[model samples]
Target: MNPINKVSQARVMSPILSGLIYAFVIMFAGTLFTSLILLLTSANESNLPAFSYINHIISLLVGGWVAGKKSGTKGWYYGGMLGCIYTLIIFMIAFLSFDAGLNGRSFLLLCVSLLSAGIGGIFGVNSRK
Candidate 1:
């Protein structure tokens, strides 16, 4: 293949990588936004722990759908991975940031996050193609 062709192919691949990064950023921002909202409103901090995972799921689904529309299978896969990564990061942050007195709930949240990502990936991949 010509050098130009190789460069073009790389350009094509760049969007997928970009989408993955964007997805993670979106999820992270969404988490922060949700946390801020909950904090500002003084809305029962009791549920704050659960809200983090919920926000992550919503963000992942939206991001995955957008990525699918923009890219394709690669977008779906990367988007889902991004979601998983975002969730893991947020989980760590939450664990360290708060003393919510969680009892085994963190593990459950992780499982829920994984399931949500899987569902978002499937929906994105199948719906786009």
Candidate 2:
């Protein structure tokens, strides 16, 4: 095959890249949705954290679906990876932007988000076409 064909074939086989892109898309969409919701509700920064969890959940579901759609039968792994990457990026952003006080609740939320994303990914992967 020509090198261009080989590159195209490689791209087709790259679930990781697809998953990462899905993650970014979902996260961006989630952030936009959450911002709009917050603006509509006039939610202050203090209450934003509580509402943000809902956004995370939404993002996870969407991300899982995207990953599953991209990966076919291997969607579970791809989705999970996407979730992990998304969480990492979000956490870093939070750490840099706000004073997310290290507390029990914060820790719990982190754990829950990770697990929820993983489960969502599995479901997405196994879901019917």
Candidate 3:
């Protein structure tokens, strides 16, 4: 099947897609945040690392909540999936752009992202009713 046709025929609504949309929105927000940070501090002196980490968590929180709402079941699973996907995208970009290597702290934060998102997911599911 033609990819375009396939997409048109496929289910348009689902937890996964909702999470992706959220992630995209969050990425755009991150870009804007990055611009502001750059303006505020010199590159070498900038707290980009810490700020990005915080931003990522924020994104996961919002995205996870959205995912849970759409999922209707297994909210935490969907949220964790969303966080993992988002993290992978971020890591891939860093690896490609700067040949960055993952370290222990990076792994720890990845787990934290999943946990934070999962918590948000639970909140989302419970808050609805």
Candidate 4:
């Protein structure tokens, strides 16, 4: 087969799917790290909430960056879409597992996630490979 034909035949995953996978992985790692910290040290339990929020933000930002870089155009749009999809997935999981309901805090999280991902996407598009 020709080189060009071979390249075209390769399967390419969507950027959004790629970003979501990265986001989930990052979240899992952060959760594990946070749990380890809480278990190993006498850290104040009160800070757990703050740490969780930070972790989510970081995860979304990185995921958005990956999506933006992969798409190589319309970074903000791709990142925002990724954030929206991520939030919906999380909401469904929370509802199913914890019986969590949408509320003010959830709204805030959605907004923050969108903003964080958008910013990361902008940066990613402008970044040099």
Best by lDDT: 4
In model 2, what lDDT does residue 38 have? 73
Ranking by lDDT: 4, 3, 2, 1
Candidates by TM-score, descending order: 4, 3, 2, 1
Backbone clashes in model 1, listed as residue pairs: none
lDDT of 3 by residue, 15-128 (tens): 766876886688679968787878876765356777777777777788788888877678898888877887788789879998988998669778978987787677667767
**Which lDDT tens digits does candidate 2 get at residues 19-128?**
55665676678788778877888677787766667767766766666566656676666666766777677667767899565667656666655665666667766775
Instruction: Give all candidates' CA lDDT scores.
Output: 0.62, 0.66, 0.77, 0.88
**lDDT of candidate 4 over 1-129, digit per residue (tens):** 645544444438887898899999999999999999999999888989888889889999999988888888888998999889999998999999999999998998899889988877777777736
Instruction: Tell me the spans in candidate 3 whose CA falls farther than 4 Å from its real position.
Output: 1-11, 40-44
> In model 3, which residue pairs have backbone atoms overlapping below 3 Å?
none
Q: Candidate 2 clashing pairs?
A: none
Off by over 4 Å in 4: 1-11
Q: Between 1 and 4, whose lDDT is larger?
A: 4
Error of 4 at 116 (Å): 0.8
